[model samples]
Target: MLNGLKVGDKAPIFEGLDQNGKKISLKDYKGKKVVLYFYPKDNTPGCTAEACNLRDNNTLLAEKGYQVVGVSIDSVESHKKFETKFELPFPLIADIDKKIVEQYGVWGEKKFMGRTFDGTHRTTFLIDEKGIIAHIIDKPKTKDHYNQIIETWEK
Candidate 1:
């Protein structure tokens, strides 16, 4: 498993610029459940689908006391365009330096279409109000990620 981090572990704190260039930190959401999701890139098919799924269910997530945060190696500019294009309602961290991904251990080797490359793995950490990881979704279904999250937490 990435980072060897497991449920109940304290999540690594992160601070970075979001799509709007606003500073966001994990500490800022203290006392709130956090849906910390890491995607490979912005605008890719799977990534877009995953983001839109979260966006569509953002209200429900908030109603359940969950705050969503996205992170990728994409730049702030790229994130801005992606956010605008998709009308995403959550913060997309412009992790251009890969610090957050590295900290989360989501950055690593990946394979696609008979090719291998180093990139960010799609992963989600369900963080509780206390900043401890309550669960981890190592392979989220992009098209139905909202349901997946809700089910995981409900269990």
Candidate 2:
């Protein structure tokens, strides 16, 4: 397991600049369920797919009292371009200092093509209204991430 956080644990509170340079924090959605997703990069294939999937289902998610937020180690400018390109409706936090990822325990060593490197692990944390982690999607399916979230919440 790449995460130290567990279901029912209090989700860590964090603040960062979103794509629009607006300050966004976990506490902003205090009374609403949160879909806090962390991705490796902004424009990568899997990341794009996951973001778009969430974008497409944003209305449905909102109807269910869920708020979506994305976090990545990319800069604010990078996130702005990605968000504009994909018409993403949610805030994408630019975690350039890596504090949020570290707090969430999603920053660690990852191996790709037999090469080891430090990066953000793609993970989704479903935080309930009370700021407690309700579920953790360690290996989210990018193309169908929204459904995955809904199903997990429903179950």
Candidate 3:
């Protein structure tokens, strides 16, 4: 397993298309902190709750000068539907190939119905202005995620 990235390591740069087909690059947020979260899929129960939590706190994160963005293997169409349904203010990148998730080490073996398959392991990464990862929240709780993010920024 690629322990791909860790706290204190520089965040990997990636370019991908957002829900609306807009090009997004991690490099664009050079001078701002980034809350880059990865979830399992679109519209699923836990995923939806987690996404809405982040979506609700989007403005707070922004006010703290942090950019919040989510990534998943869902296609642009699925992303569009999810965003529209929840009115997510932040962009959700479509990583259908899981390239970005794989690069970040969030894609791998996961248990579903007690069966194993390659998929994303719901995780959150806090990337600082210099592109270095400040924190890595593996197995984040849907309800506590936003509060944890805010607490992270306060520290």
Off by over 4 Å in 3: none
- In TM-score terms, candidate 2 sits at 0.98
Q: Which lDDT value does model 1 have at 7?
A: 94
In candidate 1, what are the lDDT values of residues 96-127, reduced to their tens digit? 88899999999999999999999999999999
Candidate 2 displacement at residue 12 in angstroms = 0.5
- For model 3, residues 1-155, the per-residue Cα lDDT tens digits are 25568899989898888999998999989999999999989999999999888888888878889898899999999999999999999889999887899889988888889899988999999999999999988868896788988776677
lDDT of 2 by residue, 1-155 (tens): 35578998999999999999999999899989999999999999999999999999999999999999999999999999999999999999999999999999999999999999999999999999999999999999999999999999998
lDDT of 2 at 146: 95
Residue pairs that clash (backbone atoms under 3 angstroms), model 1:
none
Q: Local distance difference test, per candidate?
A: 0.96, 0.95, 0.89
TM-scores of the candidates are: 0.98, 0.98, 0.95
Clashing residue pairs in candidate 2 are none
